[model samples]
Every structure is written in structure tokens, then in C-alpha cells.
Target: MINRTKLCSTVVAVSALLAATTNLDAQKAFNSSDHYLAQPLIKNIYTADPSAHVFKGKIYIYPSHDVEAGVKENDNGDHFDMRDYHILSMSSIPGKVTDHGVALSVKDISWAGRQLWAPDAAYKNGTYYLYFPVKDKQDVFKIGVATSKSPTGPFKAQPKPIEGSFSIDPAVFTDTDGNSYMYFGGIWGGQLQRWSNGKYDENGSKTDLGKADEPALTAKVAKMSKNMLEFDGPVRDVQIVDKEGKPLLTKDHNRRFFEGGWMHKYKGKYYFSYSTGDTHLLAYAIGDNPFGPFTYEGIFMNPVEGWTTHHSIVEFKGKWYIFYHDTQLSGKTHLRNIKVAELKHNADGTISMVETYKK
Candidate 1:
């Protein structure tokens, strides 16, 4: 939680920014060679936390629809009080993006509270599954699933959130063998710090344990059942360690998992990339297994103009592109615009660093 004064200031600041930017023209077209300065893919309304995927030979993005809700800011993410979702799709990068409006809303979800956060999509057995994290009636964030026959959809959210789910940022990865797993967690206002004991503790530390020397909080992972509506097993911690197999300490903020879990496979290695929230870097680790003791690699994306950097990576037309957000659209931390950049993987299975805000 935050002081009332700080909260009011944040809300007023964001509202002022929206007023100034709502009438501005859209950004320039994307440049693959220099995507650090790439233009936003959507401009009519604010969006952040892009979860890009390719389905049926087209690019689709599932992101939180950013709106000026006038809610005050706090460590519990009160200021980011988004109410609904919109689906974005394009046949190609640097092309026209179509906003398939109002996929799902709080009013339509029976058990949902407010603030629907970042979402991801998966296609399985002729059905498209939309996975998202939203606060329940009790104000606890729970990951939920929605379904649609079309990749772009007005999805029908399930009646309840997944039984064993907790926290936010749901990234689903289906491996080569047809098995699926979800990686999720976020700290600070995201309420991830409250789940350190494998269960919710309302009085838990808002940030972390304040133990800089101790291992940092781990992200959670679990396999999805065949129905894709439930967890097949117990949710487990995802260990991120150094080359020598030491857990990243709480003080090592630059390279630890914070939020925005994106799992992609390259040449037989499981690449688990995530946001280092407070430090604002996009980092990745690799392991031989999906349920990883992943070895820490290095930072891939530097900070954008905003305080939060959430992203997704997908291969489109045999070329890899990363979808992420920055504050350039509104010059406000709460309001953001999504952008895309082409990614390159080295011969040794290493990724090239992406400097988002370059001179």
C-alpha cells in the first residue's frame, strides 16, 4: 500500500497525461533494422503488457486495455485499474493492426473483481484459450481462462479462476510433445510478495522479505490439465540461478525474475525470459527442461521510457519479433503503447541484446 498523498499525485499525473495525449496523432511505421525506435502497433487506445503469438499464419496480441480509471496508485497496483480486454491482430508486422474490440469485460465475468491484467493465448484441439489474471471478489489475483472459436474473439471467460492459481501475468507454453505449462508471478503491488509461503498471507511484506542476501522470490509454474481449464499438478517455484547454480539473491535485481513470464524454445533449449521489474530489464535463462532450474543468461532488453516493461516474443513468418510497451505514447507511466522489434538468435543459442531506448 502507498500513502494517500502519493496515490492522489499518481492518479492526477496520469489523468493529466491522458488528457494531453488522447488527441495526438499516431506514431510512425515500424523499422525492422532499428526497432529500438519502433512505432506502436495500436494507437486508438492505450495498451500494455503485450502477449504476442502466431496462430493460423497470423499475428495476434492479447494485452490489457489501458484506460484512465482515476483510481489512485499503490504498491498493490490499485492505479492500474483496467476493466476489460481487446484483441489485436495483423497479417504482418509493420502492417495495419485491427482491434477486435471488447473480448471480455468485468461485467461479463461473474466472479471477477476489477483490474484485468496481462493476458496470453494458446490454440489447442480446435479451440483458442485466453489465459489472464484478474482480481476475484476477495481482491486476490487469480489466473483465469476464456475460450473462443476464432483466434480473434469476444471470448467467454470461465465461470471461475483456475483452482490452484495465484498472482498475475499468465504465460502459457505448449511444448513439442503437446504438453502445456504456465509461468506466472509479479511482486510489489502485483501481490507476488504475499505468496512466499505457497499460500496467501494478507499481512505479508508488500515488496519482498527485505532480505537482500537471500534468494529472490521465484516465479510459479504448473502443467495444465488436458481440458486446459485446470492445473494438472501442484504449482511449483521456478528457480533462476547463476552459471554456478546459485539462486539469484534478492539484491541482484538486474537479472532476477520479476514479472512478465515469456517462454520460448530455440534449438532444444527452454528459454524462459521475464521482466526484472524494479530494475526494468528483460532478462532470460535457459534449461534442458520446461520445469526449469534455468541457468541465468543475461539481459536482452534495456528499460523503456516507463517504469514497467512487459513483453512477449513469438516467431512470425520464420522471423522472431518481440512485442513490448513504452511510455512514449502518453509520457505517463500508467499509460503505454505497444511496439514490436525483430529478434536475432546467435549460432550458440544466445540472444542479441535489445536496447529499447537508444540515442
Candidate 2:
């Protein structure tokens, strides 16, 4: 016969042991600061295309989560194959990166393929909108938006991708007048595709690839609707030209907008920032207006020891930062990790160069 008192005691002891173990696991999961002890803001995972924003009082970063292919059929080390995104945040305290779990994943997006790329977040009207790019079944990359009531979210993506967008690297800029604009594109001439005839088609004409050193098409910018679900107007090519209306270029044959396009408004000036291709240096141009005849400034950061550098600039608590990624942690060209460094703007409105952090 079982003794009731002894059985009750044994049950209580087992319950206590299980609770303790669960608590320890929770602590370990939330201990993200421990992983970010190195210069890279995150560790143990590959992160790329860091798009940062100052929401409420903390700095939130939206970066594409890079996972190396483990399945024998899925191995393609040369190509990018990010499948999800993780939101990382830190308060005023430095060196603390709290992983906000999976904000959105390819599985959540019905129209999207597995190539989940760069993403940016914006808060408006009590809702947070995450603008991201994903490949569709047609093998074309399309930009889409997701929403969440909280900055950190298991975001719900819209049923359809943004109608007029057919490129990658979607960055949104909200002006003081409450108007918003989206800038996005990628390599292979950096042209914006249009949505016509029930499909995304090329814009205007293609660039001459033979003239690689000459300035080709820049990023395409369009006014977004108030809800940010659709485009308000035609997507136009960004004007990167000199006073003579000639397309400008760097000496080494790089387009103004190769992959990443981040816009920042400061002191009534719109800074169009992007990554110059091949060389992989962060550069920018200054424009009086968002869709501007921007004057090329120069490189903001020298090339890191990586093949790519996609980033975003944000100001948190009066200090500015440039969030970017490199291949330091993975020790490979494709698997990158997010990193950040302090940025300074000169009195003339030009930004100072950001050096890679080493600790």
C-alpha cells in the first residue's frame, strides 16, 4: 500500500525540481548580453543587413538571420539564403543586445519564398510596420510590409506584397510633415521594376553594363500611402547627377545605389546613403529633398574585411550610430554578423567615417 503523506512529499519535491529547471532555462534564453561580449553586437548566430531605429526609448535593430544550410540538397554556400528575421534591442546600457525572438519568418509570409532579406521597421499610429523583401515563386524579389502592435512582435505580414515594389532592400523615411517615402533596389544596374500587366516589369530601360565605371541608375523612391500598404505615386529613379545633369560616379566604377539604401533627414537635409558595389564601402549623397538631385558626398566607412556591408543609421539618446554587418564571426564571406559603431556628422552636414570596431 502507498503511504499518502510520503507520496505527497515526493510529488512536491518533483514539482519543485521541475520549476527550478524551467527557471534556469528561461534565464539562459534571456541572457543575450552574454553572447554579445565581443565587438560584433551579436554572437553565435549570423546576422546581416542591420536596419536600426529608435523606438520609444530603446534602439531596435531588424537584421536578416543567416543560417548555414545543413541539408544535403540545400547547400549553396555562394548564395544568400536567409529564412527569417530577429529583432535585437538594447537600452542606454552599452554592450547589451536582447534577442526579441523571431519577429517574422518566411513561413509566416504566404507569398514569400525562403530568401528573406534586409528589413526596416517604422512606428506610426500605435502600430509598428516592418518593411522587408522576399523572393516569390516567380523567382523575383518583392518588398512587403508586416505589422505588430508592439515594437517586438511575432509580426503578421500582409497577404500580398507591396504592389509597385519589385526589388530588395526596402528603407522607409518619414518626414516631419508626416509624409513617408520608400527607397529600394539591388545590383545588376540598380533599376526599379514596375508592376504592370499583372506582373512586375522593368522600369524605363536597362543600363549599359559595359560602362560599369559610369554612374548607372540609382535607387527608386516612391511616396507611400498613409497605411504604408501601397504606393501613392509612380516610383522614380533617384537623381544622382552633377549640376550639368550628368550621372555621377566614383572612380572605381560603382553605382550610387548598389544594394542598400538608407535615408536620414537632418536639419532639413535628406542624406541618401547606400553601399557601393564590389568595393563594399558605405557611401552617401546629400539632397535638399527626398527625391533629389543629390550631390555625392563620399565614402562614410571604408571597406570592412567582407564582401558586403548593408547598414542603417539611427540616433538614440542624442548619440548617433551606424549599424552594419561583416564576416568576422562566421570566418566566411557569406555568413555575416551585425555590428555597430558610433557615427558623427560634421558641422557641414557630412558624416564622419565609421571605423570597424575591434575588441
Candidate 3:
């Protein structure tokens, strides 16, 4: 009963409408430049465990490089070696990073010898201090300190290792009272170490602030002696047990939910972040004090659909944004790409993970 001409017109109109709707959806998905905003902060260089510190308004990213591969040669060809720390700096831009040249190189340090991994840079007074771990020919690892007047530096390593302990992943935190502390540990009995005056105790122990269900330890604000390396108060033992009171250490393997420990204080509370699992997914806990009776805060970000995630957190910049690494494009090479995304905290303080880029 419908006219042939009218039926044909109706079919054409519906097709045109569908085409217009598809075009509009595509425009909404692809119009924003945010999808194209990612630029390599560091180049073809495979870097990992990136930590950023803002000094004099410039951001310095100190990462462990595959320096060994850069220097070694095999029968077929030369392989990239990860034997040194590579420091890169950039000016502050909301969504961009400008590659400042190599701020520090291990080959330039006299005592490094070989195998410098996971360097952390921090500025105090008029000097920039880089805390990094290095291994000798025997493969024994130790943490050391290097000082420079500038962040991008020809850094000079201390004549010897700090306290002669086999440690790596050194992170330095300075309290409001001018006291400095260093936290470093991995599978090999990870423990927090403190420094005061000019002398450091290799046997400096950590305080065991139990989990949230337990009583919190009294927060201490101690002063450093003239030596700048020794602590004045009793160092407490840090508990590495989970909520069920079980040890976090894995007997068969080394690393047990313990690597890349970072602490930040915000609004009078301190947050401790670390990496866990064989895949190194980012996990965190919160405490009222730096030496914490911390409670698990849950996973900030897990491995994506196509990539593995690790060593990351949200930085407060007007709003909170998470920074992490992804390996979707680069295979198992550890040549990971850094990503940033806004983080939304729930009423109960839980965080929601969102896509790093707009697309």
C-alpha cells in the first residue's frame, strides 16, 4: 500500500541519517588533540623506574639505563647494556616534556666501576644529591651517594658505599625540620635506613608500624647532628607483614611485594607506594606518619589490556594525575613509555583508574 517512490525516498533518508550519526561519533572520538599529545620524554633509550624531582622549577627524571647493552658486544653484534644511571631534565609544561641532555652518567663517576641502577635525585640547600646503587664485578650491590651543585651534573660519587650494605633503589626524603632520611630495599631483606649528622649506621633499622587495625607508632621529629649522616633517636622496626599478619617475603624467590618504595606527605598524612606481583603492578598503603602503620589502599592501576604497568602514582597539580609506564608498543625490552592521567578519589578515599590518553 506504500507508494514505490515514497518507499525509495524513505530508505535514502534513513541511510543518510545513519551516515551522519557515524560521522558525528567519529568526530567526538577523534577531535581532541589530547590523543596526540604524547611525546617521548626520553628517546630510544630503554629506561625504567623513573622518579621525578622538581628543582628550581625544572623537573629532573633520573632513571636506570641499559648502559651495559650500550657498551657490550656479542659475536653477532653489540647489545645494549644497562650499567648506568641516565638523568634527564625538562621544563614544566602541563602536558609536555622537553629533553634536557644527560644530567649525569655513571661512566663519569669514578667509584661507580660498573652496574649503576635506579638512581634518585634530590636537592637540598645549594646542592643536588643523587643516590644510586651499583654492583662490583662479583655482582655484590651497594648504594652510594653523589653530589653536584646542579641537577644536570657531572656528579662525583662518594669515595665509598653508604655503610657497606647490599642495597638498591635509594629514595631520599627530607622532612620539614631539615632532617634527611633514605629508604632502600628489595627482596634481600628490604629495610628502611635513616641518616643524620654526617655519620650513617649501616645497621640502622626500621620501625615496625603495624597495619591500620593495630596501634599507630608515635611520629618522631628528630634533628640531624653536624655530621649530616647520623640519627639521634631510636630507629624502629618496619613490619613487612600483611593484614593477616603473614610475612610478605617469598622464600623461594627474592622480591616479595617489595620494590620501588616512595613516600609523599600531603595534608598532614603520608602515603607509601610500592610495586608488587611478578608483573610489577602498582600498589599503595596509607599511614598518618612516614614510618607508617599503613593500610592497603588498593591498586591504583593494573596491567592494561595490552601492556604491563609498574612504579607509578598520582601527583597533586591543581588536580591529581597518575604517572605510570606502559609496554604496549615496546615488547619485553623494558623500553616502556610513561603515561599520565587524572585520578578521581571516591568519598571513601578509593581511587578510580582511567585511560592515560584521550583516545
Best by lDDT: 1
Q: Estimate each model's TM-score.
A: 0.90, 0.81, 0.66
Q: Estimate, for each residue in 1-359, the C-alpha lDDT of model 2 and write its tens digit.
A: 54555644554465356435533443443344343323678786789899998888888889988887653321122267788888999886365799988889899999987678889888889999999888887657888999999898989999999987877789999988999999988754233423323355645323223333445656789999998788999988787765466787533334356679999988899999898655567888889998998877788886564567789988888888888876666655567888887789999898987765322
Model 3, stretches more than 4 Å misplaced? 1-39, 67-81, 93-95, 188-237, 240-256, 304-316, 354-359
- Ten consecutive residues with minimal summed lDDT in candidate 1? 22-31
Question: Which digits, one per residue and each the tens of the lDDT, describe model 1 over residues 1-359?
Answer: 33555644654465346433432311221223243468778789999999998898899999988888787766677878888888999998889999999888888888898789999999999999999899999888998999999988889999999999999999999999999999998987778889887789888877763566679997999999988889999999999999999999976777877889889998899999999876667999999999999999998887676668899989888899999998666866688899998899998899998866445
Q: How high is the lDDT of residue 199 in model 2?
A: 51
Judged by lDDT against the true structure, how good is candidate 1? 0.84
Better of 1 and 2 by TM-score: 1
Higher-ranked by lDDT: 1 or 3: 1
**Candidate 2 minimal-lDDT segment of 10 residues:** 69-78
Candidate-wise lDDT, in order: 0.84, 0.75, 0.51
Output the TM-score of candidate 3.
Answer: 0.66
Residue 179 shift from truth in candidate 3, angstroms: 2.9
Ranking of candidates on TM-score, top first: 1, 2, 3
The local distance difference test score of model 2 is 0.75
